[model samples]
Target: MLDLFTIFSKGGIVLWYFQSTSQIFTPSVNALIRSVILQERTGNHSYEHDSLRLQYKLDNEFELIFVVAYQKILQLSYVDKFLNDIHLEFRDRFKNELQSSQWFSDYTFKKSYDNILVAAENWGKAQAKLPKQMRTFDESFKSKKTVASMIERKDDKDNKKQEGKCLFTLVGKKKKGTNGTDDDLISSQEVLQVEAPKPVQNVNGDVFEDPLMMNRIKLAQKFSGQKKKADKQKSPKPEKAGKKPRVWELGGTNKDLATLERTKDKPEDEGDYIGADTTLIGKMKGGIQDLEVESDSVEESDEVEEIVEVNKSPVQKKSGGMLSMFKSLVGNKSLKHEDMLPVLDKLKDHLIAKNVASDIATKLCDSVATKLEGKILGTFESVANTVKATLTEALVQILSPKRRVDILRDAFEAKKHGRPYVMAFCGVNGVGKSTNLAKICFWLIENNFRVLIAACDTFRAGAVEQLRTHMRHLNALHPAEKHDNQTMVQLYEKGYGKDAAGIAMEAIRFAKESRFDIVLVDTAGRMQDNEPLMRALTKLIRVNEPDLVLFVGEALVGNEAVDQLVKFNQALADYSSSNDPHIIDGIVLTKFDTIDDKVGAAISMTYITGQPIVFVGTGQTYTDLKSLNAKAVVHALMK
Candidate 1:
């Protein structure tokens, strides 16, 4: 049974509603609108919020919405037919008022709604009563097969050749064949006589001259010779040498003890840390706001304008890039499933070519087809532009961030409260987790914020040294002399092979006590499938509770990357051992410059996690870190 049914205008006005329960559904409905409809995920057939399952339909021409809500456990079938029937009935009954801009007037549709609901329920019951039918012979694969294809032929010539070879010395008689050919037939008594011969001594005076014995001896000798050769080819092992400790050239000494002493922490001096300078802050902001992405060559044409124009169509453009090709199929009438299949298929291919996941592209095309069904296109309007516009809008909505992460502003807020802003970087091995972490740290320090890099990546060799080198370079760029004898950046590391969670916790504590502006935790790069490593990552995030947990991923990934993101998010949620587990907060897309226009990874990551991409790593330098610009990314994708 349906729990709620509603009809409303696109402008937030509830035209009419019916409910069987007193439960409040505003929150659930609003969630559907925000997360699915507003996010351009209309290709999805149903949405589950709390215990309710909601299905919605959009009336593009009339600017109306029809939604049916029911309990999640119920397997409802009539709701779709019921919604369709009611939509047509209500539109036909009130077409004049709908077109006259009289939306605020009262609608008396109770009788008509009940009749349509009952008819739909009856139709569903009838379908259930029918028995399952068997498929016809023509529908089976056997019906399409041929007998000739199933037969296997043997080669008589090869068989005869194999039989003609003599195996041993035997007495045989040649008989005259019918075709004047010779046929040899062996005699059993003669074969036994030949086999009864005695063995003879060889020239080496070592064993016997029997053919079987000689062959066995030769095989044994060959194996022994090969074994000796293998032994001779083996390389000698080198002697182990003593290990030496790594030395950093920037390591402090007794001569700099005075300068280091002034940088020491005091309880009451926590609030005295200097904030980021204005010039550096502006530079950081400009980098993010003005991020440049290379679009496709097709972008130079008027395609972008066409896409934008189609989006403004009366029905919100329920079309994709191929709508123009199939415009003749839906001329002067409502679109059916058959009419839209070719167009949707073409759109799906287009999206896949644009680097979208195959499954995701199919779903997006289904959604566009759903939005376009039962809508009539104008007689004189260009269908191609309309289709392009709708697909472009959906792509743009998907790329748009649901929530913004203003790191600079938030860091200052944390500074004012006399605490350190903590951020942890986690991802698979060699996705540039440490490299991007360094880039972000550079950006933070550039804004005059003192930063601490926590090297908790104790698993990989040289992880600590790599971070130390970056710390040294960053400090050199902003030396103590330029910052009133105060070091701009510091490294907190406990060598290698320690507890990463414990290290992160200690680092955060030290940063707070040292009055540092930000603490960037560099975790070990681990595969999503590694349970031990994933647990350690979960422990780090759960215990330290960093302000941001960024999942660093390579943009040069495809369908496999989807699995990686899903597994990482699932591991974080499953292993947190808490009712309110914290998963990935945002994404840090690495090697963005390498993938020219294959920006599907960005969409896939954001769609799976519903988290915004906070930082994009375009180049190898620290200055290459920038914020994601949704429009630029969409432009590149469409191109």
Candidate 2:
């Protein structure tokens, strides 16, 4: 029996639903919508959340979703057939209402759903009862056998005819020999022994062997001797050097260590991020600055429109174009998979060229093909134009964030409750996790928010000192006298070789006690494949429970971007040992300025984790951080 069946609009309005049990399945269904549907992973056949496996089909023409959920342990073969039957039935019955946008109206689909489900179950049973087909001659391996192999050879036939025959008869049935005893007869065989012939010698007393063969033997001996000599003359391997611990440029001595040490009870002085006379002071009004990813001119959209119109014009022709496959497709005819294969292949290649992961590109193209497979084209619309437009829309929709990640507003809300907001930055090694953390810290302090930098990256040798250096630089920029002798930024570090999770917990406590507005925990940069380090990261996030968990990744990556994000998320979910795990909440894409037009990493990252890119690091300075613009990224990708 099905646990639940539902039909909903793409906009998330439930049109009709039936439940066989009283158990609430809202969370499971919503997870499917968010992780699979919204993430453009509909190419997958089923989505498993908790113990319920949800299978769904999309109604592209009507913008509807039909879903059926059941226990994962059950092998319900009829679910797919039932979903299809009910989808067609419901769509046919409500065609008029759906065409008129009456999706919100109450739908009485229980009777039709039951009839379809029963028929599907019966069909499945009938299929199970039928005998499995036997393999035909062509399907069997015998069909591959050659006639020559099946026939017996003449030599084999002679060997078989000679079987059970002896070279000598039993010698007249054992003739008697000496002493009147039965004796064996002499064998009918002859034996002859000969000595080896002596080598022939010439007058010079040289053997008559081939002169060239003798010469070759002598040369081989000479070469082998030379090789042995060369082996003995080889030099000895060098000894390895001892490893030296890294020394930071700003390394502190014993005397300076006292000043660097921080205590939780120490009171902080109040100050803003910038000084009154500072040049950047005027630009600090906004809580967080937005990224200027898109062009300032509005004419770019007009140019895009013109290009699209040109593509749609019949006068323009492409050799072996996408429309060639659809030339036989007449007006008001439904599109088929074969009709869209050529265009999908081209689009897939286009996406891959833009640095999108090959798997993601293929899936995206498959999803687009699925969407357009049954839709009809207009009278003047070419298949190429339709596909291009649909692909553009899909790209835009994918890049757009489903939910806003406003750190400044959340910080103010945490301040109102007199608690510090915590944000943890995590990612693979060398992806600039700490650098971007400092950038975010700068932004937070610029908005007059008291910020505490937590150095939880105890694994990296110079991580704490790096944060310390950034803290010093930011403090110099915003001195205590800038706002009534208050210090705008401070660092809380317990040195290296400490438990990062413990340090984060202590830092959050210290921030709260010290009345800081936010605590930015800079975690160690570790590769996602490092199990021990990944487990440590999971423990840190699980223990600290930061207000937001940001995965810092480099935009310069191509296929590796998918592996990093996927393994990171998988580690969090698998190692947390909780029903509700603390996975990555958002992404911080660094090195955005480096990748000029290959912005597919943004799409790949978002698609894999279903998280928005909250911060983009465009340069080395703290002010280089900016928010991600979906449209701008989509434009760059399409170009």
Candidate 3:
């Protein structure tokens, strides 16, 4: 018996297929076979593996007819005749539909073609039962009537009815019992159903009879009884008398001030140091509100001294006391490398947890440690505060770029020169290259520059259509104020299966001729590992060098973004002959809001690549692009 049959067009696209009930070829296997045949360009061949055989015939038009069957049952002549008939019928029937590329999902066409395969299977079966002398192809299936016969029509109908019965049974409908009569199968009248049993009631009127529910009720009651008994066993203790609140002595009283004045006039001694509690160091730790020191009495001095209001709550007081104690212990000692080791370790762990590359985290920690060694500690300084200050300064220094491109200014300058400021966006697949390109277009339009989006992403299936959708949305949201179609925000697509580089070159020419200020070229998404695709991207850049090449990537990719940028830059350098070698001038991080806690991507990417992030995609809108803020990113990481 013929087990599997498939047909393919000249370009290796599947046109139609059929499978027998015994064994079927997987879609992937079918695609593999098609790719092999298309690549090898075999005319007619038979391949055997184990007990199965795969035979295919290529027609004059390069259309493939493939059949998979068991080796023992194979009759080459009969199979060849069947294939010829199928090809003739398919070409004659689907002639008009095959001329277009959009006829893959025609349901009526599929149904009519499927019936022909049924008739062929039926004819094969009938020929198998005949004597050897009478088994000629012409004798068995010469007439049109014979070719139109179907043996599985009744079986197909019965299968559909059984499917309906299974669906009804699944959805709580009553099924026909084994002893059901013919009337039972045909009747549509409603049958009276039995009512469910009433649940048993307990003494407390709880009506649940399910065993699991009964067990839960018993367990809850047991826990509640134990909780009540435990609560009764505890007794209240007598409250202790509260201590008097400590008063903070800012300056002395009037009498003490006068005595201090009298003593100041009397003599000078070497042993006149104040105690730790009354010194300036103690006041700093308690959070200084005010401080005053005078040798004259309050009446004599015209300046009225403001007193510091200390916290009265015991917890606050206790915390203040602990701070004072710590300050006194470490006030005079210089910070050693040993003192900061624990803090640096913790900082390294924090950076790694936030998705910073492991090596980058180590470098950051080492940098901070180098700056902190042999540093003097003030009375109120703590290790955590020092580490934060050092880390912030280091990150800010790393994130600050040496050269920055003001896109708006560049566009205005290009317009003054009567040329368009072109920027090409590239990235790995599904990283939102096209959407972010549209975002940049919207940004340019808002900045008073006439913009055009070039939909040069022709490799992917629906790349052109996706760009068109974006253009329509952007036009609807922010329509051009004063311009014709040439100058307004328009999409230029050469459609799919065309050379992307050629499309981009033409787009730039179009922009120059149309006098647009900026042209944003969107390229197809490809993986960094795909050398052929990456080389094509490099060619696109080399042929028509854009003013800026920005790498668009996902923030959630973390350290992997670093690898992508590096490899892309290397590819551009290796392929392009330009003196400046097409490197990523900037990065646009997409889905920035999705990576809630892992925010080290921005820091790691900037630090590793030395490329500043230009804008971040925060939401799905034209106006959702936000300029990168270094302080905000640092704060988020530290938080």
Candidate 4:
């Protein structure tokens, strides 16, 4: 103890105290240091996190750094002195075991389990510090669909690969009463609380003779047989809806559908590919028209001021909260960025083709159907959805008494005057932020606008290659790193067709040199510790005070996209001095042509974070970039 006191007085508490946690010390004074480090290793994860938080709370209390240090020494190093701390170990183990036993078996049966575990993991130990009523598991799981699933099978052999699944069929049949309480009352063959038949007084004060009780088992069997017989006699689920050969083929009624009726076994309906070749061609053509119309609508309506008319569905909207809403919004939806990007990108290209199709052909329902269907997998349900929506639109237009004229008015009231000239892009890696930046250079050159780029991302091995690749792809990009000194000279040469000091100066140098029309700087991923790197970014901003500074982040990031907005804002904390800080003028959500969980939470987060979404990466092609429109975004995500 005296030695420890000597160590503490020497300011060497941690280095001297080998009795505590095995950690030595961080180079800086940050209580959340290990918390952050451990966080990087786990997402939505819980493992002794609460205990650490509890320790943090205690450390902050009573000005007891050394006392807390000694407590931690006792707690973290308990294993070393196991014999003396057996009770502590036993207590912790028992709690953990109890939590484990009570945890959700699967997401379905896990309603209570997940809430309990999350509540415990995030705040398990906080109970000592926080109120018990506020920490109720029932309260935590009070959100919609928190405890509902028809097919939660608890009988699976326990091999916990995190969770298991069961698809349930809703079986609602009038079951026969068992034990013949009705029959027993009649026959006196079974025991009952009340006599088999007796005069009883009703709540309405009417006296009536009770009906005879029947044997429940026999009645149940009879009812069960009756249901089975009915199932055998009923017709199958529709293979065709009225006159229209249904695109959604009734596959020999699944167990769920079978409850209603056993669909009659008819000749194979090799669906989608219409047997009538003539009708197929007509539908395909109409599909093509639909695609073109939708694409054109997107491009045209983007400039309109969009009033957010939420889909006031009787069903809940998916944006109630992030974690809960996302799961529901993407029901049976793919999470991988790759799976969806190509599909959307392909749809875009298909639309582009339809847009260019002859005016006469564009109007025909058959042309729209033909082109869109050709792109669809014959086996997919989405194909039917796409084709049907198009046909429906076409029918409405044709059947209208007046030639339908959607006025295509500018929805946006043009921001008072016009718009701020900030530009950004959204798309996947190969979609070309660098190439587009260079193209903007040429566009600026043609319009006599000045522009310079800063290459701040030093992590990706091939990042330099991509920028240099832009040099070849656009013939306007420079092939050198930009640091602190030569940025002004490079911008001068780029703007005035002359060379400046060198290529690698501060980002501010380029902004200062040309500081007017536009100053484009390339950024990177892995934005966690953007501070150490912000000197270069700050130098660019201060020197040139460029009209717009855009943060270039990936589009296909899905849920983690929120992290980019957070980290970047942290890095640029100095700039956000006012109600409207020198925030990111725009966000470029890159990689639009991939299969990402496009929850677009990033866009919504932008609003919360006070940044504007200014551009979208439409495809893999260099020209696929488009201006951001809130309505367009809402439509894509909702559809």
Candidate 5:
């Protein structure tokens, strides 16, 4: 066989020559190395004759520049161009690596060959700045006859030759086995290729020089002169030529984060996905096999040379052993700065119970991780404190604790004991009093309550309109409309009543006369301080006092107003005689539609008077109103 250098080098005398020179333009980094840089070092020597010798040294920056120039100069190539060239040049090296590694697990010869071709393409891209002569030599074989032959094939003639200028030019006739060619020379299998690139022009007339892209690759190279950089700074590789395979290098936190909890902008519910590409997994597994093979070879041969070179490759840095990575997390407070899965699990239900969001629950879990080591618990007090602080802040931004509690408590109580047979709703104007009343009517119906609604609110046209809309919701839930009649109400001192006392007398007289099993009185939320109104209400109590009085108040009014209601009604709890009247028996926290808030929710906490919050208004929709449960409120605030 001819020396590899003789085949590669552009210096050879094909005695009795029938020379044929083929020029191929390829985008490959390997093809980039085959570029003929004919510099005019001599000024007009015998009509400007400059010998085309080779420059041996190049930096990564130069390689990147060459890569850019190659793309611009080379025509689009596939098939027997870049891939075939790499295969012809490298030959059995990559082929052997393919069979040894079993790169394509399906393990067909065609697939393995393609995979090896792809890996070379990727390697070509990585070493894009390598000097042309040094690429093949430094690439795999060092100081071999291939390198020598690559440097000296056939010396170029003077300017008269102008070889490879137009098409596949015939440099000369072939030699016979590194000797003089006989007369009848047949086709030769191996031919030297030096790509004579045409100057390609873009539409803008300016070359697309990717300087940042070039610099990025330069910085990524393993040189002592360079400072270390974050993985995010690495440059993106250029696209491979057609039919050329390229390696997939997953870098950067967003792509190759080791932890399961990745904030990759995918949906929060997508679950843990850590380096889950089958092709990538196979590549990783191949590396492991390589390590195992090396380990076995070392044990058998007692080879110290192989062991010394282990740390030379970037693989040593990247191939973090799974066991070692786990060990690192053991004594650390966090793994990938993430809380344990168990902590998140416990916090999740706790937050849900407290009325917190999934995202906040997750944050709470992270905060807990700050106070712990692997498999160990954070302080019970710290955990509680953190959860409470986070949840309190969250709830204050959303809804009040006391109001939410009362709303939940009452609804739960009602649900537990039995949906209310006789329940009343009370609240101020625009406090969603009537709307909440409609909600209760709907909830009772949804829960299969024999609900009976009385539209005794004979004032506020919007209130009546709002309630009518809510009645539709109630009707849908119950499959039967609540019986409502306005004539049964004795509101506004209208028609025929003697005075306030007489009007109150007839209001109660008429409500019972209706003989309803469930009676929900929609009284006016005019004033808690009004004496005449209170007197009239007292008259109703004397006549046919209702079973429950759910005094409604605006929850967004915050703790101060809630305190007023609780204080006022709770004070009335002591009243027994006709002179001293019971003002408010229980509370229905209202106006939940305008606020899903924190300061607003905390403000309602001032009304923490042990009064069971029977109902809550959540949204403008009657369906939005949810009954507050105390336990649920406590969990929401803490978790």
Candidate 6:
């Protein structure tokens, strides 16, 4: 059953809250829920807390959290359907209010909340009557075993019936074999034994159904018949008693006997043959069978001696002949640009297609071409493969950071020095400066740091209110810790039309006095061509020297973002008198998830400005911000 349903902005701000029962809701409970939602690394939206289960459905701008409480398991499909319906209806009902800040003050919000509560109650009643069989995990597993046993018994019975039919066919065939003559039956058995088992075929020469089973039956019957015949032949027959009793009598002619005796009595020397006569002696020496035995014996003796010699000697090693020769001939040869012109041209096309800026792609290709020239290619490496390897290496080098900034480490260091770690965000208008500032504050809060947001963008009409709204939402998720009666994440806002630089300086002084660990200054969004606005931005940095200045840009802006950063840095150098000129320490890329194929902006920005991209905005939510991964970016670009 659905116990709770709530809607949250992407910044982890709870926009709407509902409870089905009379359960008490507390700030701690809200914090716990937010922690679960924010700390989720995998995209899985479901989490369990005690007997309650929480499932989240994410939209582009909002997240719907459904909480289910039960003693036993209920059908999740029903719960999902209920939540999805509510989400759609809520989106439709408050579409405009959700995007505007007026929803909090609008009187219609109460009526909308009441309507949603009534709908949720009706949905709960409808789901209670659903024909869903809720079961424990153990009970469901036992029922599955019962069904599996029934299936197994049915299969065994069917297999037995099949075996009976095959056996009956074998008996009928055996009767025909018994009626044939013994020699013919033996010859037929031998032929069947020698033949390979083939698939049963129909009259059309196509394979029959159950060909494998039929082939097994045929082979079994042939072997069984052969065994029976062999048994019959092995049974010894009684010998004929009178057949072996006959004996030869010595009745040979006297003259023939006298001649044989004379030849046998002759001297051994007279039997010796010489020269041409030796041919007849050789012919009479042995039969074909005897000669084959003698030749086999001689070969076996030679083989034995060879084996003995091999065992006595040490083993010889084989050298890599062909491989070594090939390596020597071509492995060390340097690559030339002319040799890889075709491959480089194709690579450039691929990069451009993947949304890399045109100039950046050309430069990348040129750099790769320069590195490839006079570089040794491995023995098995092809020109295309070598070029790809070199290009990946160069990209990795550019994307990789020389030194990483540890935000927590820096914040703690600032605390030791009795000052907060101050960071300011500057970028052109509509680049999501205020939203990203809240996101970083949320991150710092999650890391256990007390943070303060300075609303210094007094030039923009509703900027202060926007920052306050963000603070309201974030405070609900991670409430401020009270220090000397001052709340964490408190906003320092001067009304519109005030000096922006003075407001920032006051905010920093307030943070130092309040003992806050970090302060995020939200500066007014301005264009680089606006000279007065650019001067104001520079003055803010000079008056209140922030530890880090981040340039926020949209990845969808492509190569033009580089131009904005360059101009901003130039203005800072001209107006600021500090020995260390104000420069963008890192970059924050917004709408990173929206840029599906074109990822070249990040590379172009970093390569041009020589700054590292620190964080990327994956979605509108505060938790959507993630650390930039160089390898992941390169992989996405290459794809």
In model 6, pairs of residues that clash are 10-621
User: lDDT per residue, candidate 2, 255-343, as tens digits?
Assistant: 99788886532324742232222454435446555655542322212111112245566342333432343233236767678867776
Best by lDDT: 2
Tens digits of per-residue lDDT, candidate 1, 1-639, equal: 889999988798988999999999999999998998887788876899999999998887677889999999998788889988998887875596767866533345787778888999999999888898889999999888998876655776678775554333434455656687764343233332112224677788775556664454445445334231221366788988889898998898899888767532222353323332233333553335545788645542322112233556532333333343344422566655676676567777766776677877877777777667666776654344445567778877877788888888999999999999999999998999989888888777778889999999998999998887777667766778888888889999999899999998999899999889999999988888999999999999999899999999988877767888899999999999888899888999999998888888888788777888888899976677877888888778766
* lDDT of model 1 at position 9: 85
Please estimate how well model 5 matches the true structure, expressed as its whole-model Cα lDDT.
0.39
State the lDDT at 307 in candidate 6.
Answer: 14
Mark the regions of model 5 whose C-alpha exceeds 4 Å error after superposition.
1-421, 447-515, 534-543, 570-585, 597-607, 629-632, 635-639
Model 4 segments more than 4 A misplaced: 1-436, 442-450, 456-465, 475-517, 529-531, 534-544, 574-581, 595-602
When summed lDDT is taken over every stretch of 10 residues in candidate 6, the lowest stretch is: 291-300
**Comparing candidate 1 with candidate 4, which one achieves the higher lDDT?**
1
lDDT of the structure predicted as candidate 4: 0.35
Candidates 3 and 5 compared by TM-score, better number: 3
Q: After superposition, how far is residue 578 of candidate 1 from its true place, in Å?
A: 2.8
How much does candidate 5 score in TM-score?
0.31
Off by over 4 Å in 2: 6-18, 25-35, 90-115, 126-284, 287-289, 292-330
Worst 10 residues of 5 by lDDT: 286-295
What tens digits encode model 6's per-residue C-alpha lDDT throughout 392-411? 76666676665676677888
Query: Which of the predicted structures, 3 or 4, would earn the higher TM-score when compared with the native?
Result: 3
TM-score, ranked from best to worst: 1, 2, 3, 6, 5, 4
lDDT of 1 at 302: 29
Give the alpha carbon lDDT tens digit for every residue of 33-79 in model 4: 23321112111111232123211111111111221122222333222
Q: Counting only residues 3 or more apart in sequence or on different chains, how many pairs clash (N, Cα, C under 3 Å) in candidate 5? A: 52
Per-residue lDDT, model 5, residue 638, is 44
